[model samples]
Target: LDVPCKVVITAPEGEDPHPRFGKVEMSHAKHRNVSCVSCHHMFDGCGDFQKCADCHIDRDDRSYERGFYKAWHSESEISCRGCHKAMKAKNEQTGPIGCLQGCHEAAQK
Candidate 1:
């Protein structure tokens, strides 16, 4: 797969269009060492890649557990912040992991 060097994630539809933290830029290049499915959990080896919001929506029709917010913030490796936290716990070199850092650093107003 010809993965892009970077992938910027924005808030899902029905959420804040201009989010406080702005967009989260993920480094697919840096993550080349990791399996693609690590982040793209729902991707099948031969299927079209999908946007997270395509499945994890922010509609009030479902529980927050299935909502877009949890998809990104959940304490699971499937989540960006969660993966970083897990790596930190293993004493591995990781990027920022603070509420004001990592994927949640406040964006410039």
Candidate 2:
């Protein structure tokens, strides 16, 4: 659980959790707004972060031997962006997308 570390501000009593967890904040802000796109996708303005295991079952050819947790979380609980950023420079030379492109593709304007 990446709680407290990145949960940012907690909701006041009965304030509504949806606004606090919804895309409006992330779309309009950064840092204080956590971009969840690394593990999620927005389709028709709907955000979905289906866990990796749903698609990566043992019967699947692309399934990893170590399991979804290992494949997705790496050895530690590093976010997907963290892994992408770790390879940003090397990916630059290879012409692959870096962390910036991988997640925050839409530049804040």
Candidate 3:
């Protein structure tokens, strides 16, 4: 008789070098609906996500910048989805470009 053993694999805290950073407690229950493939692509995955273009606008080859992550999280250690979730709840609005309806809404607030 042969027995089968199952191994449980857990992802490291945070994606890569950007591990939590000791700012806030990580939320395990949140982000249950989001999938790893939702944010990642063939080349880069969710771990490589950046916020530079998120708040910037490009016009005629010129890009203007607005608030940055530093201002948004205020030096917290929450994940991207965690932050967005709160902003959406606070705003109580939803749409394509709006905050509360997408992955950003689920990020750290």
For TM-score, the strongest prediction is 1
Model 1, position 25, has a per-residue lDDT of 77
lDDT of 1 by residue, 42-93 (tens): 8878967898889886655434776877777778888776888899999998
Q: What is the TM-score of each candidate against the true structure?
A: 0.81, 0.27, 0.22
Q: What's the lDDT for candidate 1?
A: 0.74
lDDT of 3 at 66: 32
Q: In model 2, where do residues sit more than 4 Å from their true spots? A: 1-34, 41-44, 59-70, 73-109
lDDT of 1 at 62: 35
Tell me the tens digit of each residue's lDDT in model 3 across 20-104: 3213222323434545333221215334434333432232232222333332232222324334555466794422333333324
RMSD of each: 2.6, 13.7, 13.2
Superior candidate under lDDT, 1 versus 3: 1
Query: How does model 3 score by TM-score?
Result: 0.22
**Deviation from native of the Cα of residue 82 in model 2, angstroms:** 6.0
Candidate number with the higher lDDT (2 or 3): 2
Q: Rank the candidates by TM-score, best first.
A: 1, 2, 3
